[model samples]
Target: EGAVFIPASLAYLIGTNIFGPLAYKMGRSFSSGVVNAWNELSIPLAKKFEHLLAPNAGWGFAIGMVDSAMMPIMGHLVDLRHVSVYGSVYAIADVAFCLGFAIGSPAISGSIIQAIGFKWLMWVTAIVNMLYSPLMILLRNPSKKEEKEVSFNINIKILLTQSKIKE
Candidate 1:
């Protein structure tokens, strides 16, 4: 457990740190596909670690990597769907995503997991998200200039600084 725990935590930290910034340049759906695809590797991992009583370092790490990357990707995904929002109207978009994440994730996950075991659930999730990603790329949604790109760095910068910078 100790071996698995440390490696998994480290992997999650690395994934979120690395992918959070990378997700900026890669765009939302693309980066999400990259992360979500990590679950497919778990099939091989499940085989590799089948003898172990608990999650081995590799299995834990792989799941950690995907799970960690998924966190920040959620924000990017919200922005993907709400790219053009700005000013007072941005609050609406923010609330919508927050509500969906806070309320919707549990609702969807419970039903899905009840029908499928954990391992198969991950595989299904991985395949479904990966399959749709290229379609999202092909069917680009047109929007205003705000939709084109967002500097997440600016948000980080604001948080670090004591004073807020006016945009």
Candidate 2:
């Protein structure tokens, strides 16, 4: 319990202190991509070193990090995409998560893990999570507004030069 608590506490603190602001600057889509990318890269090594870290605490701590980080970042995405209705969107999402937690059980997860095999289950989860990284492409980059201003200025300059040449 101590091991799980310590790691989980650390993860939450770091997520709140470090990742939260980073996410705000990077935008929800990019931050989520970075998080997933880092996880996909780190997970295999972490599994190999599982015993060294703590035998049974891995699942608890990892789940804690996921729970801490995923929810708010997703809320941020809803904020970006639907500025006016983000509150409603987040409320529905929160309710859905609560229902999932209420209905989901260790036995169900255990059965699925057994059927899929733990490694396979992990790999499949990684792949599915990785699928989200590409979804960042669909998101309008947060910097696009600044980029548009710069590009617009450049375009005007080019048009002026072209007109002068035509004269």
lDDT of each: 0.54, 0.55
- Off-target runs (Cα >4 Å) in candidate 1 are 1-12, 40-97, 135-167
What value of lDDT does candidate 1 attain over all alpha carbons?
0.54
Q: Report the C-alpha lDDT of model 1 over 1-167, residue by residue, as the tens digit.
A: 34535654665566656655554455534545644456444543554444332333334444444444444544444565665434434465568757877886788778877888666777876788678767645423434346224567676676768455533
lDDT per residue for candidate 2 within 11-45, as digits (tens), equals: 55555555544443454444454454445444444
Best by lDDT: 2
Steric collisions counted per model: 0, 0
